[model samples]
Target chain A: MTNRILYVLALSAGLAVGPAAAETPVTIGMITTLSTKAGYLGEDIRDGFQLAIDQGGGKLGGVPVELVVDDDGRKPEKGKQIAERFIKHDKVKILTGIVFSNVAMAVVPKVVREGVFYISPNAGPSRLAGKGCDENYFNVAWQNDNLHEVVGQYVNDKGFKNVYLLAPNYPAGKDALAGFKRFYKGKIAGEVYTKLGQSDYAAELATLRAAKPDAVFFFLPGGMGINFLKQYAQAGLNETIPVFGPAFSFDERLLKAVGGAAVGVRNGSQWSHDLDNPANKAFVDAFRKVYDRTPTLYASQGYDAAHLIGSALAATGGSLSDMDAFRAALERADFDSVRGKFRFGPNHHPIQDLYIREVIETPEGTITNRIEAKVFTDHADAYASECQM
Target chain B: MLLILEQLMNGLQLGVMLFLMSAGLTLVFGIMQVINLAHGSFYMVGAYTAATVTQLTGSFLLGLLAALPAAAAVGMLVEAVVLRRLYSRDHLDQVLATFGLILFFNELTRMIWGRQPLFMDVPDWLSGTVELFPGAPYPSYRLAVIGMGILVAVFLYLLFTRTRLGMQIRAGASNREMIAALGVNIRFLYTLVFGLGAMLAGLAGVMAGPILAVEAGMGEEILILTFVVIVIGGIGSIRGALIAALLVGMVDTLGRVFLPGLFRLFLPVAEADGIGASLASMSVYILMAAILVWRPRGLFPAQI
Candidate 1:
């Protein structure tokens, strides 16, 4: 009787210890804007990230992971509070997924200082890419200015003599205009910074008409872009002036909302659904099958962020105790990115090919981006020189 | 000179839209003495309903027709169910209850429509531009909006001056208890007034649908402007709302257009642009404050 009782105790002890020793899932906290007007952006990022983990059978690169997601509602203060909870209560060692640059500025600097690893899926603010660059912070996305710089070069190549610029009055908006001016050697007819969430652009459009630039470049993302494009078309200015912008305004979902107004406009992006790559094809197909909608560039970044972290977890054997090994592994970035030819510059921002995409309506009447030309090959951010790291 | 004329037209167009929104809001506050923060939710409801209906039927007219009744029904239902009990409550209680309604309506739209904004194109008939003058071409759709605002204003004037229901509404705004004592079905009258106010907001929403992105929480932006219009024009007076809406619209539109240019004459371009943009956004609020100092009870306060 004594021998049998001891046997039962040993078996129960083995059952408890066996799984815990073999697989202790790493917890990753994701803070992104999932409410308000920009909620769809964060939804796509979350869906794409979750898709990668789902494909791995609740693991990434054979290492188990648990993703805890929260919405920031596009507020900097709310983002800080969520980050605090994730760090203190959840004991999350790694964090990712912030959609807005302002929220990232509030959260990333503080968390990275406390020794938590941050892999940004989107929102590569210039400040973080330059003098504020940190070793613990890894952006799996291009610098905020990279895509805008491509359009500037394209506009210059097209021989536009005068360009009118418009963007919201915010940090990212300033970065967009600055990036465009860096490559376009043309006369700036007007540089206007409108209210961030202003719905009516009638006043600005009237002023833009008066300036009479050869071309117009704007960086209004999400609903702001939709409002601008629709109103621009209605005002009958679209027929006379060619419109240009970055990929944020031309995403698949936003294109659907803007409809015919977005067609024929050219925008710059780092990745597209039509990119010729095995990894990209698979990711796009799988994303469509799962989400029932075409994935945006934001989704691609989220997928890449997950795969990058997975590769690092695999390299370090799922052990986060040695921060140095994990950091080195992340720096190596031995993952097949959907963008193709992805690498990190010294500032931990993407150095990859950027393409010019024209918004085209497919034969089926769905509007999407078609890659027209590659503007830059193996390009690094202009701010890399400013980074000491 | 052409640019100045076009800017004025833009100001006039924005003014009429604000009038549509504020007329209903002022009437509700004036007659019911209940603060409805969820007034914007009705505007959102109208936009969403119109967008969806237009997409399904391929008719902008039908969409506009459907939105009016839908918004009125919802407003009446809310007034009957949630707001009916709050009539005798303090202003703070009314404010709190209506604020909760805003969140509820926002989430409800998100659930029904999802996060993606619905697209509503300008009808082909109204999509063209008109030569307002020799050099200035303005969108015909904007002109239609201005005309619609004028039509509604005339309709309201005729109703208030010629109709018995309008007389009761004016009387009720001044003395609710007296109307009740005079055998007016006060509850039913309040509901009808609320519905009428909601219909005007719906008209504003339908007009804005093609011009703005029709998404959840779209009403909150215009709601703030509507409040300013009502406060500047005396809170329960339709005449006051019209004048105040136009004034606010002119100040806001002209300020946005010429402020930076005004500053450029004296200051460096970049610094001037920054300051001008900031001040332009504040122009309407400044006007409101200036008006209040001159008339503590608003420009056309309802006679007690």
Candidate 2:
């Protein structure tokens, strides 16, 4: 009797349902720098991305998705290997989530050549934005130099004529300082590039003190930023000359590590937790509820990446086969971003507003970023014009 | 001149921190003939424990106090279980085992504390800059670090030359089996030495927590530098570790500060900075190489 009832129900459902209602589950391969000193970055972005997926009921735009996460261990070779495994074994339709620019460069070129849609949650390297631009690549985050350029413009707006610049000696570091110089019409009192991950910044801090610039600008991220800020405050230079940086230095996670040292420091960012928008409020509230901590800019970017993918999937009906339709849907960017408003420029990088955030000390003795002013409006990246594609 | 002096002080501060790490590492190696790569894990443990305790109790001193014994206990436990098995093993085996221990401890820390770096604030009294000389101000926390390091060095010196335990340790370093044959409870001695080394590392970690980013795998980076210190200073020699650590610290600090300027005197702006940056990063290793060429057994090899 039960078998007869199941057969009748199955026959009724088959007769009622449309023939075109076949749903394909989308698989996204996320390769990031995890399981190292910089693992927190990957962890944050992963959490943020997962949070979005969770909030969307484990589906993007009414389509189910399987998210495969892998740790790159902050090595380019490891990242490349993981990318290959993702492409070959996993058959991941869309690739996203590389925390470091080096790893992004290593994996993006090879995988994008295979006709996979690559959406970056973080690390918008200039090479990918300019001559190396590809039709499939979409950077949900700002170009690497955007925040630093915002700082430069902010410094110029603040009327600081003499500024000292410092960053780690690397490609991103070079681009950061160059971006700063692009907008700031000021005398570079001194320019220095310290070694990457150099924890003891006393030598550089001493030189910074001696140079006596009106303002100091640095782009030391991760542990480097924590060390620099702590030492800078200890040296009492924070009392004399104002220090400015990109949000990478003064993010929520790092601000907690640096404690009171980073309080009152101005940094430029494309997103802040306190941005007053319905979409941002929902994202932030849901994120804090799930994670029990404030989300960083990285987390925001990851959330946006998920939403971007979701919008495209919704438009294209969970299918990545029609390249034109998928590309058009992604280009439309018809999703509510935590950053308020976002649009992909010609190079598929964000053309969004950058905000100046001040690290403020609350009455409860917690340090967090508070948006002070809009530094740039609808800012397109410098390399977008260079991208012939 | 003041700038030079300040930079020197900075160097001294870095040297002192490294001394704390190398002292423990050198002692463990000298006594046990065990290449414990997990020595840095003790440092990390100390820092993490201190951060957690400090956050719990709202007292920085209490956190530091807690950090020392926590790390020492961990060291003793690891020795009792894992390190004891590796003593008679070959150097390669010991290296492999200790490396596994490093990974184990790193994952363990991650499981307990999560992935984010912990924050340890400098105590209120030690949080500001103090005038080191006329018109020259320095961080009090750094000065305290220098002072504590010197005190530890002096204590270690006296302990080795003036105390029975120290003598036993020195004896063990020179001839382990002979000391065992001479009715010394060699096992207990090794455990004690290991604990002491762990305590020193823990102390360094506790002191360093306020300044450095206290996170997982923090030990590995500093561990390399500590190894360099031991190699350059002569392995298993505290005095050598001390001297070599100071030298390495100063060379590294001063090189980064002044090398670019020196290069600019001879080359164009871009070329000078490029060469200077690379050379500055390499100066400490260069010094290590030069020292090794002159003294292969290290500058102060212990008397056999």
Candidate 3:
């Protein structure tokens, strides 16, 4: 009976195959956290990658490209399952789109094992840059701590005598604080680690209030950043002690949530929507025309990843086996990156410029970041030394 | 010295707000014998409702007023349709059903509000900081939350203890079938009680909206704290929930503030900060576990 049922299922599966499967496109599988608190940034990453793909008219080399999206829900094991399905089931030659380090960490290993190339648009984990950097893996984004170190430089440059640093208590959080301390040369008032994705900052706020630091540096991203900023403003400390943070801490999504509170706040970024470059200008115009809102760094990185992969495919004449040719194409890096010229260092991470941005009121009464100064040019990450790769 | 007092006040304020949430959860558990995980969804709904109304009406009072009935209606409808069926089922079924409700509520909220947080203002009357002590001023809005919490505790005590309705509720909690045999219209009672619990949670939401970001998934964070409150206080005991809620809130707030500083004395600042923050984050859960070890059921188990 089981054999008969299996035979029937096999016969039925052939019938379920639609005519749409015959004229197949280049299947590109993108997996990221899309169902939890981090969903907004994940949406930006997905849309940003798709915008580039869409602009290519659903084709990468005159062949239609099919984009498959899977939500990891911020779980590493789940990400691995999705990666397996992408490679084995979906047959995606190049896999991309992971926002968190753990998710990328889980998925990249499996992809490398199968010898399929994985392009990480974000989550530039130190491990991947050094010993973990596979020949097939290339990150269009910089090492995670590069932007944070720039914020650290800005803090020291401003000559704040006493500063307090706060981040969620996690591995990534440790990297952020470590990055800040590397370039900051003054007396450190205090360093704090709070619960990862913690909403309540009252106790920490009370302590910071007591410490009376000149400025507070924080690395709370996504919803955590939104909560921290509102609470900080409500505690009447917004203007009293200036807050220094990175691009991820504030973005188009955050500005809408923050309203007037985000105004005049200085946050560092490698790219802002208001950045005035020829490539950036063209990218911004095209993105706004398409999405009807400003795109964040998540989107920009996603766009860059799509372009990088497309260029690699183009360089190899759309073949997956030419590893040397693909590597050479990626190394030449001859694509229009919205953040300006970014080249992968020896570790396969972008060595790029960082910008310190201040939130300003636009003529249309929307809050947007204005580039204050270029903090780093061809900046290297702190953890590169730790990575022997 | 001054900082200690200020931090204490902050902790107390957070505790009072949490009491509102615990009161609802514990009551639902005590009476209905249903572990409603979606209790936080009601809180999320109430907060979003209050914020949207405030934006539309431009009157904080009106928003608060409309939000009460809106939240109560939503609660009553949910209990009538979904929760009523789960009351007789296993705890696992109840948890699964309510968990599904959480997903539905989160998606519904996102669809309506478009995933951005809505800002509600502290009313003009309660916007300024009050001089609670000499050289120490606390936000008047937070102080109002404390006052409102005390009022809720008093009202719940009167309703559940002194009034005929209170007698019926307690009696029903102890013997649901017996009360129904007495022709008490048990269905009506459950709906009323659930609605009341929802209002309590909604009140907490409205009060907290200005201080916390008013967004979807906001309730899940508070819901975990509310569970700790229920576990510590004794599930189904309103009075237990009140005391436990305040205790958990104060401990959590104080933990976030002082735990790291305590560790700072011994460990390097970086290591201390890291360890301190992690421990502080876990303090309330640790407190709950300790309470469970001492009193397996809870501090004041309503069943016993």
Candidate 4:
């Protein structure tokens, strides 16, 4: 009796998943780092997608959609497995939300090989924005370099004579460093490549103290950033030197731990909570009401990805067979993006603006990211031209 | 000199916290003769519990108090159901089983907590900064962590030295056969020791949550360092785990701070910085490697 009841419960829950159009059912395969260190960002991305779908009244272009969430555990191998599952078993028409760049790198090729549309809401590795870009791979997020360029320009604009570069020792880390150096025309006193996912920052900070650079530019996200910021504050350099990075380096989730120490540090962002756009304002208000917290840039990308998918689905009249049609539909970028005026390039990455924001103290919570300056106005990513597709 | 002193203190503080983790891990491994790779999972569980309770109840003391028993109970349950069957198994089998436990616990956390990281707020009483030296204000929470570790260490020392159960545990460590012959309930004792070890790990976890985000698989991230601490201190030695953990923490903290400057003096600025950064990151692993080369049995072997 218990077994039958449990089985019935499971089946009923499974039946409850789709949005309600009752057209040809299409599955969206999403592989994200939902079970590991970067799970917080993954959850935000998931929430953004789900919330968009829920608020869209469960139908994308009069077609019911099913989403299959697979936890990649931030592993390339796991991501590949999910990609195969999506392609083979589920016949997923769209693949999305591989949060980590490495995981995206692992999964995107499968989506392309299978001729399914993969919209990367996050993990915009520079390679994809350039020669490696696939026609069907629409990125709702900016390339790794584009966001870094915002901070790079800000650092240059501030007229800092010298700066230190900090990032993890990985492909993404190297790319971020190169991206920062691409625009920040300053004498680099030091460039420290930390161990990937390194939990301690004392030694790196020691080198920084000795170098005494005008500022520190870091690209650590998730727990590594949290650890680095904590030790950096603990090392007593919070007051001495300024720090800056991409918006992912500090957000509502992170500010809660680093606290006042994370304050006074400036970072470049694609969207601040206080962005001046009606679409963005609506997103922020609606997101705040539902989640009871400010959505990070990751969430913003996710929201945009879902809306873009919905728009494309409507444009195609919910057709899955016409590959060119779906590709063209996604490229239109007609969705009301949380990040303003997002238009896709030939490489399928967004051409959008980036901002510089300061972490301010607010009465409601620790997050008070106010736009201190604007870096890119309708900026096209540097690598877009290389992407002939 | 001032910088040196400050960095050193930072190292000691980090090291002591690591000691708390290593102590629990080594205790379970040595006395129980069971390789509980899911030991860190207990810490993760404790921290998550503490964060949830504190968030719900708005009291750190109450949260902490709840965290201990909750973690202890989890530890006891794990021992009874999963670990009890594997006591007679080889280390390889034990590792595989416990490693499975780690994955299970991580997945369980995700399903329960919905994967959004919870930020634990520091209670007002412990949130104030204390001046460790003239003009140097350290956050009262971090100092509290140090104080907690010292207190736990003292308590552990007393428990092992003064109590009858401690004598039995020590006996169990030396000769399981002899202890079994002595008409003691080894099965019950194992469960109790596992629970105790779990409590220690949970204490470490709850304390750590206020600083770190209470998220899934945090245990796996720290598991590597905890392993390093165990290997350096010695397998099957609580004293060794404590000493080695603190040593590693200090070396790692101090190395990262000073290595680049030392390299900058010798090499070109960019070259020096890169090499120094990499070297500083690898310094702890290097220390571990060196220790292993010299003393395969570790700095303090538990016994013959």
**Against the true structure, whose DockQ is highest?**
1
DockQ of each: 0.84, 0.78, 0.49, 0.29
Candidate 4 chain B: worst-modelled 10 consecutive residues by lDDT:
B128-137
RMSD of each: 4.2, 4.9, 4.6, 6.7
TM-score of each: 0.96, 0.96, 0.93, 0.88
- lDDT (Cα, tens digit) per residue for candidate 2, span B1-304: 9999999999999999999999989988877888999999999999999999998998988998999999999999999999999888999999999999999999999899888888888888998889987777888999999999999999999999999999999999989899999999999999999999999999999988888899888898789889999999888999999999999899989999999999999899878987898899999889989999999988897677
Candidate 2 lDDT over residue span A1-389, tens digit each: 99999999988875654343335468899998779878888888898998989987899888788899999998999999988898889877699999989999998988888988899999999999999999999999989999999999999999999999999998888889999999999999888988877888888888888888999999998888898899889888889999999999888888889999998899999999999999999988999999899999989988999999999999988877688899989999999998988999999999999999999999999999999999999999999888977
Per-residue alpha-carbon lDDT of model 1 for B26-103, expressed as tens digits? 999888888999999999999999999999999999999999999999999999999999999999999999999999
How do the candidates rank by lDDT, highest first? 1, 2, 3, 4
lDDT of 4 by residue, B1-304 (tens): 6567657766877887798888888878888888889988999999999988998998988889999999999999999999998989899999999999998998898889766566676677776566676555566777788888889889888999999998898899888889999999998998898999889889989888776667777887678888899988888788898899888988888777768778888798767767877887788899999999999978898894
Which digits, one per residue and each the tens of the lDDT, describe model 3 over residues B157-220? 8887799898999999999999999989999999999999898888888988877778778899
Best-fitting candidate, scored by TM-score: 1
CA displacement after TM-score superposition, residue A219 of candidate 3 (Å) = 1.0
Error of 2 at B225 (Å): 1.4
Query: How far is A101's C-alpha from truth in model 1 (Å)?
Result: 1.4
Q: Evaluated on chain B only, what are the TM-scores of all the candidate structures, in order?
A: 0.99, 0.98, 0.98, 0.97
Worst 10 residues of 2 chain B by lDDT: B128-137
Candidate 2 or 1, higher TM-score: 1
lDDT of each: 0.93, 0.91, 0.83, 0.82
Worst 10 residues of 4 chain A by lDDT: A15-24
